[model samples]
Target chain A: MTQFIQQLINGLSIGSVYALIALGYTMVYGIIKLINFAHGDIFMFGAYVGMVAITTFKLNFFAALIVAMAVTALFGVIIERVAYKPLRKSSKTAALITAIGVSFLIQNGTQLIMGANIYAFPQIIANQYFDVYGVRINLLQLVIFFTSIILMFILQFIVKKTKLGRAMRSVAVDKDASVLMGVNVDNTITITFAIGSALAAAAGIMVGLYYIKIYPFMGFAPGLKAFVAAVFGGIGIIPGAMIGGFAIGLIETLVAGYGSTLYKDAVVYGILILILIVKPSGLLGKNVKEKV
Target chain B: MKNLLNKKNLVSLVLLVIIFFVFDYLIKARILTPYYRTVLYWMGIYIILSLGLNIIIGITGQLSLGHAGFMSIGAYSAAVVLASNPTITGLFIGMGVGIVLTMIVSFIVAMPTLRLKGDYLAIATLGVGEIIRIVILNMTITNGASGISNIKMLMSWPLLFGFVVLTIFLTNNFKQSAIGRACIAIKEDEIAAEAMGINTTKYKVMAFMFGAVLASVAGSLFATTYYVVKPETFGVNTSINILIIVVFGGMGSLSGSIISTIFIGFVNMALQPYAEMRLISYALVLIIVMIFRPQGLMGAKEVALNVLPDFKSFFRKKEKSS
Candidate 1:
């Protein structure tokens, strides 16, 4: 029972990070209908940026976090403007391939710069453990959980209350109609990318701190799993992404705890296939019929 | 029979024979470097894989990212079979087994996932591909991650050349067949094709299976050439590389696939000097290509022999002269 609680805490901590990344994926997909395969790499970029800021520039943890988010947000905007905007009228397949191209570019480019080696992330925060009901919980995990929750709530408030959020929602619903109503569709899209990337940046820093390790290609697995999470809860729905992230994190932790670690990835992919087969719309996604 | 002996067919056959003899002579004379030979061999394998993938992605408009999974299945199946019976007959038997197994696997993957359109299907196929890799990694027969090594190397320059020709001929024929036309109809518009009584599901599955068959054959050749079959060899990167060849050549154009496969093969060789920057450059090229010319080099058109002028245009010229 104690082990279960401990595992649960670990899952929630990791799940919160997945949620941050999934929000980016869900938002980009919601607006552009492109998977933005490089979103994971953006998370990796954030980690690297945070690492550099702390180690090279001697910035504090929160400052580095803000710096990473800002830098990644800018990168997100640049990628969209340069790689995606031109192919807007092309086939979706072309866009997908381009997104994949961007992903490989970031991953390999980073690898070239970083020499494909894992770097130990410095401990920015003091590691302190707290015990509750005979179950140990770490201060870092608490910080991650609360920070993610606060960020998510702030995102929710923005989406629900802000004008830019309204524009974003309108653009997602109907791009042409929104443009007709003077929504500045392009700016809204750029903003969406920026916001999503910033959130992913936060996740990256948190993950780096939690794991105490960062690498160029570290984003691939977690990014893919976060994508699974987004699909699981309901892709394109903000709250759905949150739910899916935590669910997948928990499922993954429990499976690894009980089953062979070798098959954990297989199990996660199996669940993805099963969910896609059973509920194509996902858990929170509404069933949208093909119109044509 | 008469059509088989047509001038174009004879000329193409003679061209292929001459090319093969030249290549064999060059290798025998040691004029061509071993590096070039290896590159050509890899190019041949990629040509088969990409052509097969084109049938699914370009002609049928079904995007699959799991092609390497099918290829790995073929590679491992062939490797295991050839381990005991190391003969030409064993090679054929291995390829046969690969084809059948790939057909079955592709059919199974296609059935449920084909219902989902576009990106969903892509993700599902990707999932299935990863699942196959993981399963292979864990299986005892697959040697569990260390992979099957030191298989008899049966692939030769002549054999690889022959298979490449056969793959091209078969894929070209399949493209012009009635079933191929149905597949194209579905690609143009699935609903319209369905309305016209075309069995969309059946044709999609058939195209996918045919592609799997070709990939499997290529996989058999790959295992024999390298004398090793590892799970890591068939990953998302392999699948993407094949897709890159297909797209770079021009979707729906067999000739384009051939051209682009050779072109990229040479480009890869050239980029070997800058090993670390190769993939970065490759990704940049993909992005640039998509942005500048999404239709690719051939733009969905086939390269054919321009044997005769149009009779209508000739008559119009005559009328003007008169």
Candidate 2:
């Protein structure tokens, strides 16, 4: 029972990180209808940026987090403007291919610059453990959980209460109508990318701290799994992404705990297939028939 | 009958024969280094794989990211068969096994997932590919990451060249066939095709299975050439590489696929000196190509022999018939 609780706690921490990344996927997909395959690589970049801030710039943990998020947010906007905006009028397949190209570019570009070596992240947060009901919980896990929740709350408030959020929602629903309403569709879309990328940056730093190691290609697997989470919870749905992220993280952790670690990836992919088969719209996604 | 007996057909036939003989002589004379020969063999394999992928992604209009899974199945099945009996008959039997297995697997994968459209299908196929890789990584028969090594090297230059030719011939004929036309119709408009009484599901599955079969054949050849089959070799990277070839060549153009496969294959070999920048350059090429000319070089056109037009008009002064 204690072990179960321990695993659950670990799952929550990891799952929250996934939620942060999944939000980026869901939001960008909601607006642009492009998967933004480079989103994961953006998360990777965020970690590297945070690492550089702390190790090179000698910034403290909180300062580095803000720096990383700002840098990544700008990078995300650049990617959308340069790579995706021009292809918007092209075929969906073209946009998808370009997104994949961008993903490869970031991954390989980082590999070229960083030399594909794993870097040990500095311990910015002190690691301290506490026992509750004979179940051990760590301070870092608590920090991750609370920080993600706060960020999610802030995101929810922005979308629900802010004018920019209203514009984002309007654009997501009908780009043409939103344009008619003078929503500045392009600016809204760019802002969406920026917010999503900043959230992913936070996730990246949290993951780096939790795992204590960062690498160039580290984003691929986690990014893919987070995508699965976004789909699982219902793509383009904010709360759905949160739910899906946690569910996937828990499922992955439990599988690794009980089953063979080698099959963890297989199990996650299997669940993705199963979800796709059973609920193509995702768990939280509403079914909309295609119009002729 | 007239078309068959046309001067164009005869000339093309003679040209093909001469080219084959020249290649044979070069191989016999050892004028080509072993490294270059290996590159040629790999190019042939990639040509088959990319052409097959083209039938699915370009013609059939289904996005599949799990092609590497089918290729792995072929590689492993062929390697296991050849390991048991390293004979000419064994090679064919291995290829046969690979084709059958890929057919079954692709059927199962396509049936459930083909119902989804676009990005959903892409993600599902990606998941399927990852699942196949992870399963292979865990399975004992695959030797669990160490991979099947020391397998028989059964593919000769002539054999590979023949298969490449056969693959091109078959895909080209298929493209011009009724079924192929149906696939194109589906790609153009699935609903309109369905309204016209074309069985969209059946043709999509057919195109996918055909692509899978060809991929397996390529995989078998790859295993035999390298004398090893590793799960790692058939990953998302391999699938993407094949996709790049198809897109760069020009979707729905068999000639384009062949040309791009050879071109990219040689370029990859040439870039081996700067291994770190190879993938970066590959990504850049894809981006630049999509941005500049998404239609690709061929732009849905086929390269064929054309008769020379009469040049008498050039010399003659333009005089009205009246």
Candidate 3:
């Protein structure tokens, strides 16, 4: 029972990060209908930025987190303006290909700058363990799990309450109608990228803190898994990402704990294929009838 | 008869034959070492793999990140057969079996996973590729992580060149067939093609099978060429490299795929001096080309046959045209 409880906490913590990354994937997909393949690299950038802040600025965890998010969000906006904006008027295929190109650019560029060695993150929040109901929990783990919940609620409030959020939502649903209603569609899209990138930065820091390792290629695996989670939860739905993240976390932990650790990736992917095949839109995704 | 005897295409064909002869003799004359010959062999293998992928990406309008999985199936199967049998004839039998088995596996795998679109297909295929990798990584007879080594070596310059010519011929013939037209139709618009009585699913499966089998065939050659087989060699990264070739060459263009394959193959081989930077450079090239030339070098255009010919023949053709 205690092992199960421990696994649950671990799952939730990692799942929170997946959820954060999934939000970035889902938001851009919802608005542009492009997968924005480079979004993972943005998450990677956030990790590097946070690592720099921690190493150079010698700041605490919270300060470094804020700085990383700001930098990533800024970079995301720049990417949107430079790479994506021009390709917007082109075919979706063009945009998709461009996104993949941007992803490769960032990943390869990072490899050039940082070299291939995995950088060790400074242990700002030390691995201090706490017991709950006879199950051990670490401080960083708790922080990840709770912070994500709080952030998710805050996001829900913003999307539901704020005017900018409503405008963004309107644009996602109907771009032409939103344009008619005086929403600066391009600006909204830029803001969406900024927000999503910021969220990804937060996830990046959490992962670095938990794992104590940061690499340029680290984003590929988690980002892919998060995308799967987004699809699993029902893409284009916010709550779905959160739910899917936690589900992925739990399943991953259980599989790794009970089964071979090497096969964990295979099992997770297998589950995703099963879910997609059986339930295409995901658990929360609505099936929008394609127009003939 | 005149259309069929177009002086331009005839000249192009002759030039190709001449180029092949030059290279063939160069290797045969010991001017090009066996190692360099091996590199050329990989170039041919990659061309086959990329062309097959192009049929799916450029023609059928599908994205797959798991092609390496099929290649692994071919490699392992061929390696096992060659190891157990130790006969040169077994190598050919192994390749045939590897290709057929890969086709069957891909067909089964595509049925369940084809529902996902866009990036989702990318993810699923990525997973499938990794799964195959891990499965191979854990298998006993495959030698797990150390990999299966000391397999029978059947690959040589002649065999490789023969296989390359055969693959190119088959792909070209298919490209000229009705099925190729159907694939193009599917790519242009799936729903519209379906409305026109084209079975999109069936065509997709057909195109995917063709690509997978070709990948497997390449895998067979790869196993024989390397004289060993390892799971790590054929993984997600290999799949990505193949994808980069097709995308860089211009999707749906056969000649483009061929040109890009050789270009990338030679560049990648030449860049071997800078081992770590090889992938990074390729990645940079992909980003730059995608932004500047999304349609790729030749776009969807084919190589113009008129560009090739002997000087006298060219003049004769021009005179004849006038």
Candidate 4:
């Protein structure tokens, strides 16, 4: 029973990170129908940026978090402007290749800048154990999970309430129509990239704290997993991404606990395949019908 | 007859023969090191993988993130056979058997799954790829993560070079023929191709088979060259890397794929000094190209003589304009 409670906590914490990344993925896919393959690498970049903030700027955990998000958001905008914008009129195949190229560039470029060794996040958040009815929990786990939830809510509020949010929604639904409706489509896209990247940065910081290790290619697994979560939740749906992330988290944690740890990834991917086979549009995604 | 000699086709044919002799002489005279020979082995294998990838991505206009699964099937099959038999004849027999088995497996997997469109196909293929890797990981015959090693080395430069030439020649010929035109028509629009009396399914299956065959050849070469097989080595990353080479070269452009493969391979081998940065360089190439030249280095266009005439046109611009 205690083990179950412990597993739940672990699952929620990791799920929060996956949710944050998935949100970025879902949001970007919603706005621009391109599967931004480089989004994961952007998350990796955020981790590296956060590390730089801690070691170079000597900032506290919160400050580094802000800085990491800001830096990653800026990089996201730059990537959008450079990689995606120019190829707007090209075929999806072209865009797809470009996305791959961007993914490779960011990953390998980071590897060049930072050595292969995993960089440890500063222990500024402080590690403390809190007991809960005979079950002990780490303070950082709660911090990560709650912080992710809070950020998610804030994003929800922005997308659901704010004018810019409405504009973003409009742009995602129909770019041509949004353009006719006086929405700054390009700027909205840039903002989408910014917000998505910022979330990725936050996830990276939290992951760094939990694992105490950061590497150039670290984002590959988590990134791919987050993508699965996004797809599982029905890509382009925000709430779907959150639900999918948490579900993946719970499933992955349970698998690790019950099954061989090596099979965790296989199990997660297998679940995604099964889900996709059953519901092509995902759990929350609506099946869009074409006019033609 | 005189006009035929002046045709670009005849010129290319002659040039190909010359290049082949030069390559053959270099390997025969031992001018090229064994290291170069080994690199060529991977180069040939990569070409096979990339070409197979191109069939799905280029001709069928479907996205797959799991072509490496096909390679894994071939590699493991070949490795298992060679490991069981010590004779040289077994090696040839194993490769032939491996190639055939891989194609059959690919046919089964691709038949039902290729029905899924676009991103769905991508996801399914990815799943299929991961499944293959996991299966390999668990299989006792493959020896799990320790993999299969100390297999007989049955191939060298001369044979590998011949294989590469044959593959290129066959693929190029296919691309120029009516069947290749059918592939292009399919890429342009599947519905339209079907209306034009083309059997979209048949052509798609053919393209898939072609890709699978190349992957099988690559697998055989890898089994012979590396003499080891690991599940992790043939994962989604391998698929993505091959995709990168094909995309970087240009979709539907055989020459482009060959050139890009060599360039990327050269950079990977030569940039060992940079270690981790080599990966960074590759990533940068992917990102930059996607951003700037998403159509790849050639944009579905061949290199070689195809581009030379364009340069010639530039010089003869005034005459043609007049």
- lDDT measured at residue B32 in model 3 versus the true structure, 0 to 100: 91
lDDT of each: 0.88, 0.87, 0.82, 0.81
> Residue by residue across A234-290, what tens digits does model 4's lDDT show?
999999999999999989999999787888888888887777667768998788774
Worst 10 residues of 1 chain A by lDDT: A216-225
The candidates score, on chain A by TM-score, as follows 0.98, 0.98, 0.97, 0.98
Tell me, what's the RMSD of every candidate?
A: 4.6, 5.3, 3.9, 5.2
Tell me the tens digit of each residue's lDDT in model 1 across B97-155: 98998999899989888877878788788888899999999999889889999999887
Per-prediction DockQ, in order?
0.73, 0.75, 0.48, 0.43
Q: Give lDDT tens digits, candidate 4, residues B1-322.
A: 3343334445555665676688778988998788887777778788777877876786567777878888887788788888878565676676688689777876776776665656666767777788778878988988999889987888765667667766776676667667778978988887788789998777777777777777877787788788788888898778889988887898777778888888888987798677766666666677677667766779877665476873322111112111
Q: Second chain of candidate 2: TM-score?
A: 0.92
Q: In model 3, what is the error at residue A109, expressed in angstroms?
A: 1.5
Tell me the TM-score of each prediction against the true structure: 0.95, 0.95, 0.92, 0.88
Tens-digit lDDT string for candidate 2 (B85-195): 987788788899999988998999989888788778878888888888888888888897989999898877789877887787688777877899999999888999999
lDDT by residue for model 3 (A141-227), tens: 988888888778888888889999998899999999999999999999999999999989999888888888888778877887898
lDDT of 1 at B210: 93
Residue B239, candidate 3: C-alpha displacement in angstroms: 1.9
Candidate 3 per-residue lDDT over residues B61-82, each given as its tens digit: 7888888999988888889889
Ranking of all predicted structures according to DockQ, beginning with the best and ending with the worst: 2, 1, 3, 4
CAPRI accuracy category, model 3: acceptable
Q: Give the TM-score of candidate 2.
A: 0.95
Given the true complex, what DockQ would model 1 score?
0.73
